[model samples]
Target: MTEYWRVKVDPRMCVRTGLCAASAPQEFQLDERTGQGRATAEVLSASEEVLEVAESCPIEAISITDAESGKAVFPPDD
Candidate 1:
């Protein structure tokens, strides 16, 4: 089975701009209760949509990670 990537959300930083959802609707969702719809635990699908969303999150909560290696697709905030 293909491993899915991991995503970490800084809830404090998450303002719920919904850019990640708009960018990668298929890969991300916005939970009304949680108020943040980051990809919590998904195998690295590596679709253009998924990576684009991970890269485009305005609040920077959604991160696409390599399932096995746990490497983030995007670099840490520098």
Candidate 2:
């Protein structure tokens, strides 16, 4: 079975960099009015591109977790 991931973008931490949308347009987008990075959906099929986008966030605003297990995937647990 394909794994799924929960994607989240912290509005407080997001700086409207647009990197996430630029890197993974299919999975992320920038709000036109708020200009904040947001996940296209709360959950999506796991992919390396999504993980990369989360890791590449300059402010670490994006986070990903295993949808089933709720385990941290990006900014991995210490």
Candidate 3:
């Protein structure tokens, strides 16, 4: 089975920097009109690049955690 993870994006904290989109287009996308980035998908498998982007978020709006264990994987700890 393909294990899945949970990803969250704080819409209010998003600054529309486009970094998340640039880093993980498959997971994050920026709205051209609003200029805010949102998760394209909520559930995903463990992706190193995606986790890196979450940690790199300037506003720390992005958080990734294990779907089953609900433990924080990025941004230090849950």
TM-scores for the candidates: 0.69, 0.95, 0.83
Model 1 TM-score, all chains together: 0.69
In candidate 2, what are the lDDT values of residues 1-78, reduced to their tens digit?
A: 239999999999999999999999999999999999899999988999999999999889999999999999988999
Q: Using alpha carbons, what is the TM-score of model 2? A: 0.95
Q: Who wins the lDDT comparison?
A: 2
Residue 76 in model 1: shift from native, Å? Answer: 5.7
TM-score of 3: 0.83
Query: Model 1, range 21-77, lDDT digits (tens) per residue?
Result: 666666666777976766634554666667667667675666666677766666443
**Candidate 2 residue pairs in backbone clash:** none
Native RMSD of candidate 1 (Å): 3.2
Q: What is the lDDT for 66 in model 3?
A: 85
Residue pairs in clash, model 3:
none
Off by over 4 Å in 3: none
Residues 1-78, candidate 3: write the lDDT tens digits. Answer: 236778888888988889999988998898778988887888877788887888899989988788888877766552
Candidates sorted by TM-score, descending order? Answer: 2, 3, 1
After superposition, the stretches of candidate 2 with alpha carbons farther than 4 Å from their true spots are none
